[model samples]
Target: MTNPMRFNARIFDESFLDQCDERISAFYLMWKAKCKEGRIPARSDFDPLDMVKFLPGITLVDVERDTLELTYRLVGTNEVAVRGNDPTGKKVKDTFLANNWEDVWGNYSHVIKNKGVAFDDSDMPNSNGVMVGDETIFVPLSQDGEFVNMVMLYSIQRKAAG
Candidate 1:
């Protein structure tokens, strides 16, 4: 479902495609392919049917325009495995402690404010010194055809066993 005529300004460090694991790179590519005219795509633009193959690792976040808050509307199975639970319906900010919330603020805030994509491998920190690693891509989604109002957060993390 890719269009050869469209430009690809794929995010996630841009070089992440070369450095990250295969799954992460594929997720990033799929996201970029699904965007609307190389611009941020609205939530409605994404249909699970077309995204079925990638559904296992895709998570959709709805942006509350009034508060600029992010809510986890859909948390993928693989993501749940990494996070150890489903986070749907929870505010992204509420998931982190006050002291650590800033750790991930930039990833989402940048996309929301700039109407662009944000890429990061260090959005959330593993301060406990665990042997876990994760990569995150925050893509803005527009509403009313004028402003960004949603975010598609595709994150891939190492599973303790796999």
Candidate 2:
């Protein structure tokens, strides 16, 4: 089934850095620091210790270009807790979080296709009666410096005021 190119999330420009949450900005800054000569940073460019503060909310997704498939290589602890289950090693299209695979895939694919960052604001799933929302950023990671092989995600969960 072919899906529409536009998705629910609003893909932002670099200006998003100034308006996003400080934590998100910090994470983006860290990723930007890894870039050299305008090339997208590879996964190896990052040091785990440098990402310690954002680890709980981080996720690494592997992109299979030929098949347009996305798999969760690592799902952060905070993400797993919020979703009520770990999605690590599962294809995105098969996850319970994928109530709409097209929309979900659209967001990720946008990052890869454009080699840009995408920002998404959405209600939390499996919150078990707790009202919560998420502010997330999807960033492309290239292994060959030309093709996006993975996406690095960072999200901040906010509890809604009752």
Candidate 3:
């Protein structure tokens, strides 16, 4: 059997980062503008809600030297407001179950390592056993395109009426 980690690694595209360079650049510009306007103090000054203004399905992750962490806020009508699943200051591994967690972390790791953006779509099973299609974009955060630290954005897709 293949290792679960290996399986998770395949979900991300190698060139996904290259495709999102412009969007990620815009994000950085926004961050810089916020900082100049005194809306931000440090990297921690970012709020997931701020991202929703541009991307509804935005999520954030903080990467330290030893650990990968996810910071997000559940938004949109499709997302069930689960108790105690606050995205801010929480790791994705700690927030999700083993099966789901691996896939989520894998994408985050991919973006960080590639120092680029990644995109994916999947059908997720919810607490009520309902299947929801989720579309996400993972963007790497770096000042000079050298040191990668965090990922931002996790957008979900809504089904259209037939």
Q: Which model is ahead, 1 or 3, in terms of lDDT?
A: 1
- Give the Cα lDDT of each candidate: 0.64, 0.79, 0.49
**For every candidate structure, what is the RMSD over all alpha carbons to the true structure, in angstroms?**
9.0, 4.5, 7.4
> Largest lDDT belongs to which candidate?
2
lDDT per residue for candidate 3 within 1-162, as digits (tens), equals: 111111212335434444333554455456545444322233455675676555443555666745545554333333323222344555566665225665667777777776545666554444444444444566566543455566665554444112
TM-score of each: 0.73, 0.87, 0.56
Mind giving the per-residue lDDT tens digits that candidate 2 earns over 1-162? 122122234655777766567898899888888889999999999989988999999999999979868899998998898777898999888883534766677779889998888887665444364546677899999999889999999988775323
The local lDDT score (0 to 100) that residue 10 gets in candidate 2 is 60
* Most TM-score-accurate candidate: 2
lDDT of 1 by residue, 1-162 (tens): 111111122343466566666766776677677665656666777778977766877787887878888888988897776556788999988773213466457667777787766655532223343434566677777866457877787766553222
> Of 1 and 3, which scores higher on TM-score?
1
**Rank by TM-score (best first):** 2, 1, 3
Those runs of model 3 whose alpha carbons end farther than 4 Å from true positions after fitting are 1-52, 68-84, 160-162
Off by over 4 Å in 2: 1-9, 96-99
